[model samples]
Target: MNALVPLPVLLPLCATGLSLAFGTRLKQFQRFISVAVLTAVLGLSVALMIAADMNGPLSVHLGDFAPPLGITLVADRLSGLMLTVSSAVTLCVLVYSLGQGMADRDEETPVAVFHPAYLILVAGVSCTFLAGDLVNLYVGFEIMLVASFVLLTLGGTGPRIRAGSTYVIISLFSSMLFLTAIAMTYAATGTANFAQLAGRLAELPLGVQTLIQGMLLTVFAIKAAVFPLAAWLPDSYPTAPAPVTAVFAGLLTKVGVYCMLRTETLLFPGNRLGDLLMAAALASMVVGILGAVAQTDLKRLLSFTLISHIGYMVFGIGLATREAYGGAIVYVVHHITVQTTLFLVAGLIERRGGTTELTRLGGIAKAAPVLAVLFFVPAMNLAGIPPLSGFIGKLGLMRAGVADGSVWAWILVIGSTATSLLTLYVMAKVWNLAFWRAAPPGQAADGTVLESDDDSDDDTDEGPDRMPGTGDEGVRPRHEPAGRAVAATLHGHAVTTTTRLPRLMTWATAATVALGLAYTVFAGPLTAYTDRSAAELIARVPYVEAVLGR
Candidate 1:
């Protein structure tokens, strides 16, 4: 049972090795193995959560070495909860990828690259959550860095390579800053052990403590895509495969947020960066959403909103109250599932209409009501509509801010409300243009109609459930192009529907959406868990004691 803490990290790494050794021949086996590994991890995560909540922090020292000497993996209430949610999210994304036939033999992306890299990404995320020291956290980040870079540039396509380059440069820059911060932390405290730092850091001069805090937070802020540093994300994420984009949007940035939350609560408890965090939170909310409102591409818009909602989590951290932290925790959990589903749905929208551009897409509701419904539920939840998890999370933060009753808190209260309204506007804009409005001329009028080559930024064509408008019975050639031949062939004999959005992909997306709804259905229990987790994280004593065995 104590071993479950490290299994999440180990399972994925082991899977990565096996997938690589299989060398693409056992594609089906690799797929099933990956799924089974993640399922086990999820079950173990749930068990860890139960044990952590009951037994306090559970620590497993590597090679029987103690903290500050050997590496340690700790599963406290907060880490365990994060592990469970992230595992479930990653598992769904893996299934979604399989549904897309990504693992099939493809010239562009070798099976060797995709499956193993994906499993490595999972291990990296798990490593970050369970890390017990600063150096271990850095290692986790590096694992993620390597895996994500490969995943981002998989096809060597133009936009993907461009996005991948920018992602690499920025990630390298952040890694350097993080390394520098770790050096300073070790130089100052003589230890990288998180438990030991809690006491040692408190005794440092206020100026030194503040400097270290600033440096560490800066690195994490960049990683989290928290405004100013967030510019790379909107472009970088939208260029990848749909499943890749979905997992990136959902998990990677939140790891950064998770780090920030931990450092603020544990190491630098009263060191005073609250005001700065509050200012950053407000700017992120306003700036990110405004950017979203101006976006034409569906993926890009969701990327900007991802930045906007991050402000809510930062808001809670800045307030540093138990209720506020609780609210932020709930919000983080809500956003991960919601944001991932939105991206996955964006993939489906493109597959259905052959484009995610608002200008090109229309009549989705009339043609594929199922896809429309999939998009609608999450869109409203993201907009903070009443009775959803998003609304519940926002209400929690607003109440916390109101209770704090400071000038900044009041400003944040108003700001949060405004951000929520703007989020609604953005979601409504997507719905209006992509689903409600008619398709523009020279474009696909209905989901079944053929999309022009211009519709895809990458020149990829997707099969919709319906066919081109010229057919007598709503049928058209599966791979028809927008050329003289296609023009000449219009109004010919009816063709069979060629739907490319696979059943596994749709079912995977639906499962994730259901998980998002699960949050709302079990809101009370989830809220209670967050509340307790927040309080325990703030306490910090149990963590230190568990590590030191005192």
Candidate 2:
């Protein structure tokens, strides 16, 4: 009878259907509807969290059919907490995108269509978090993949199209692998319900159980962008528009990590795979940060850092103790907020400076002092500065690692520290290049070239500058006609250019910065909640009982 409670999932689903039906002709209406739907969903998710906290775990079967025969949406402490955080993040990103005028950019003009796809993506994520069965989780994954495919390609640029292709291919392959894993799980246990599988899986032969665990890990690793399968992430993430990049960075990969945490902790506990996971995690941290240091583009550098930080969470998972898992949970929440804020600030820098390429930009702090602070806080936080949420999270994780006392755990601890230092270096590189260097001669106030001038002799070369007339002329400059300059000066005067954040965009950046600060100040309460959620997840029995009515 619990099936009656469907609005939390259904609200977003209905919004998606509405947008698809009337998105183009009534663009404003679509935006209004999308925001309204998501706001309601956010409230519902919060209520769900409060309810779960009050009442242990809650489950609602679909179609009035019992689990093992039908689908179910289960909300325990972990899923409930995840849903609340994810909904809040998505809502903020949606508002930020609107404020940034993303919907109006020619590239995202069809972003009228984006409302529908975005809602569907949120729905999919919710479903994934709430799913009680492996098959249902697979369906949730497919839903998100399909929606993300459209979001990734929204701008229709050559790079976006190319990136979209890679994203889709990787996603589809992962889905197929997930499906295969689900088939194996069902075959082994005769039921896809998570609780049922957990009980049955524990009784299976050790060899068969390991095989199942390997398959599931492979599928989730691809999703989480863990080492050796993480190439698709940096290439694909940087190509999207800012808000989309923010949400994708904030929420998507973490879903994979969530799946991994649940699988290892619940369905296949006591497997002694901690050493293998620790090795993979160490590689992810070192390699990802190294890649970050080598990147000159702001977005690309952040993408590398994102992959690197995923290692810290995985490291916590590998430790497999209550304290370690608690740290991992806190890190997950902290990373989501901090990462999204960083990306959004980077977008603001791009909009104000006219490019994200470090070589082409300089001295933006003079023009956008507020923007400088906005970028600096989270950059430092991501680098694990004291008093910030990032440092608190890393400290928690390192403490847990030391407590575990395994050699591999110690290796992870050292690697994570090194990764944090490298992260600071990369962030500093961006700060110095983008906000500290003097503006180049003949550059506009925002460090952009005001006009193309073949003969100015004032184009300050920063990184790899391209010289004009490199063909047969061979380093010789071609003379511009005297008359051309006079005519161009007259025509160019009418074009007005400015370099400051719009009021709305300024507020959007401020809001995200505020979010980071809030996380920092409220770390104690948040960590306490995360610890409770971790405990519930490890216990597993209440989650099972709620879903199966046993």
Candidate 3:
């Protein structure tokens, strides 16, 4: 079992290589293999979490060589928790893609590459969380970026290609900055391993330590999409395939936030940059929500909301107390599950209704009732509705802010609450346009009707194949019942219409909703694990001892 510690990272890397070797000839096998590998990794992550919770940190050194010489995979409570969540989310996304026929041979070449590239992305995320050293973490980031670049440009559509170019450039620039930071840290501290860096960092003068901290934070902030550096996120995330967008939404930004938490609490104790972080956090919250409110596209709105919520995590980091850090840890776990679910649900809407543009979509509640419920639950949770995981996370941060009694913290509390309200507004905008409004005249049963030649033959079109609105001009529209009634009416109205969920898509949505509920039910234990993880991170003593024994 101990030997299996590196399987999560290795399995994906191996799969990537095999997929490349086989090319598109064995796409089905690639999908099956990827799913099996991820499933096994998910199981391992759960086992690791249980074992680490019962024991202490778990470590497996490569080639039986000790740390400082060979690579090591360490699974403390935090790393284990993140690995579990990330793996599960990736698995759900894979299921969703299979449902969308994205993994099928009929898909375009770039889209066909998703299975292999997504596996590589998962490996990178797993490595990032499990890595025991700074250089390893940087390697993980680079691998993830390369995989993401391919996934983002799947289909090679004009919009996707344009957005992807910007994404690639920004990601490459940030990676270079990260490499520079790692190099500088190694020079200053004479060690690249995190545990050793902690000890070495403590020995340095406060000024020098602050400089290193600044460099590291700048690099991670670009990854995390923090304010001023966050412009790229809103533009890039909305253009990808829904399944890819879901995984990116749930895992990518959190990876950056995870790095920040580690650096602030573990590498730089008694850090004085809290105030600067506070300012940045506030800006992110305000600016992100504002952008969300102005968006008409469902994906873009959710993208903006993502940036807004990141501020709360950073707010916790700024407080720099055990309670604050603990809250941040739990919040990170909560946000990952919720954010990914929301994005996946968005994908479902796009698939069922044929368009993600709110202005063009309506009455999805009538067509996909189950999807409506799925999207609604997470939407409310993200708006911080009481009793849900999102509300609990925000409440924890607010309570910590109150207890700390810092003026900036108090402002963050108020700002986060306001952002929540605005987030609700943005979500409501999507809900109203997608679920509440009536389908326009001569439009397909699902709000969108083909008016142009370009839209007529679109694969997403589901209505009668007759010429546009011409057939509808002679016939008067009949009043249809609302909600479930509409589904029954649609059935009676168009017996020949195809409107069933694909088996894989159904499973994917179920899995995502189940994960959200699981987080809510298991919140107590999860939070407890995160608390222990936060405590260990803040102290850094246990980690240092483990890596460089006494």
Candidate 4:
């Protein structure tokens, strides 16, 4: 089982080279390589999860070198669980992207580049989960970010390039901070390995420990998009292609949260900054949802909610107890599935309705009932409706908060509850506007715009000079009328709206939706697993021994 630790990281990387070698010359084979590799990874991850749960942590030393010198990978129960969930989500999203490429005549995803980039992204994510030292973790992040930049600017369209630029800048800044943190850690403690840091950091002076912890937390916080640092997300995500946005939303920020969970528990056992974490959680919950409430675009709306719900996991972490950690882990798993499913469904809605702008969408319930159901289940799940996995996770966290009985905990309980209500309201608004309301005038019941209304341009927020569909970078003619602008927009919408929702895409989304429901069905055993994982993480002994053989 120890040998299995490196396979998840290695398989995708090897497959990546094969994918690139095939390139556009063998598109089908490239797609096959990606799907098969991810499928293998998912299987391996599940096996690792069970093995780690039953047998403690699993560790592998590359080049036969021991820890503190050679690179090491460890898969404890928490990392194993994350690996399983992330691999499953990535595989589903890959299938969805393939379907998208086929539907678009290979225009959207560009199979050649997308396959290798996505494989690299998957390998990077797996590496981070399995990394035993700070330096390996940094390498993993760099690999992931580089691939993400490629994915984000796939078409080289003006909007995508702009959004990708913002994303790249923020990501690079965070990477610099991460490097500084690693350097400081090694300088102070003589080793950057987690197990070594566990014993050594505790011996440092109080001020030095505080400075290092604060710096590391800042770096992870920026990656995680906690409030005050999250302004880049909504702007960066909505412009990408659907599958790119979906996978990023599902896995990336959670990587940051995972790092926080690992470091806080293993390296800073006492939670010296518990109150500070709680305060950030409170602000994230409140500010993030408020931003969501103001969004009219579906993707941007989901982006804000993503930041808001992250607060729930952080809330659990701030409590710093076994039960709290268990709850946080459960919420992380649930959020990853539900959030990815919602974004995929959002893509479907965009395909059917022609745009993500709610004002222009309507009657989807009547036009395409299956899409409606697909959107509704996950949307409700996201809102924490009863009996769903979302509710189960939130309830666990709240219960843990109450048990803590601290004043900050009480405040978080109130804040989280309010955030849940706001989330429900936001989902409901989207449903009413996009799925339930009568189709806009000149738009048919099927969501096709038969003719452009002269006044339609007035309803939109885009200015005449910045018409929505004009991809050219230059300014529009000064004399262009608003009605003419509206006509051009209709033409652009027709191209997307007329596309038949491909069978493969629909099936992939349904598969993801089913995965979210599976969590609800298996809540008991899942919570039990997370509880045990939390115990091991808090104890930190199993992982240390597994890596150092001490």
Q: TM-score per candidate, in order?
A: 0.91, 0.89, 0.90, 0.91
Per-model CA lDDT versus the true structure: 0.83, 0.78, 0.77, 0.85
Q: Rank the candidates by lDDT, best first.
A: 4, 1, 2, 3
lDDT of 3 by residue, 1-550 (tens): 4566788899888987887777577767777787888898899898987777677677777897777667877777788888888888888888787766642223446545777899999999998988888889999998898999888876665666788889999998988888888888888888788877777888887878888789889989998999889999988988676778888988999999999987787788785899999899999999999999988778888998999899999999999988788888888888888888888777666556544667766766776688788888889888988868887788888998999997898899899999999988888888888887764343334343222211222445343432143333422222221111011110111111225655677678778878777767887876777778878877777766766666
lDDT of 4 by residue, 1-550 (tens): 7888999999999999998887668777888899999999999999999999999999988998878898989999999999999999999999998877776565323456788999999999999999999999999999999999988877565666788799999999999999999999999988989998999999999999999999888888888888878889988887777888898999998998999999999999999999999999989999999999998888889999999998999998899999899999999999999999988888787777666777767778877899999999999999999989999999999999999999999999999999999999999999999989865543322223332322243334222232123232434232222121111121121213443577888999999999999999999999999999999999999989988886
lDDT value, residue 547 of candidate 3: 62
Best by lDDT: 4
Model 1 misplaced stretches (Cα beyond 4 Å): 102-109, 444-500
lDDT of 2 by residue, 263-327 (tens): 99889888468888889899999999999999888888899999999999999888988888888
TM-score of model 2 (CA atoms):
0.89
TM-score of 3: 0.90
Model 4: clashing residue pairs? none
Please, what's the RMSD in Å of model 3? 5.7
* Model 2 global lDDT (CA atoms, 0 to 1): 0.78
| lDDT value, residue 443 of candidate 4 | 35
- Worst 10-residue lDDT window for candidate 3 reads 485-494
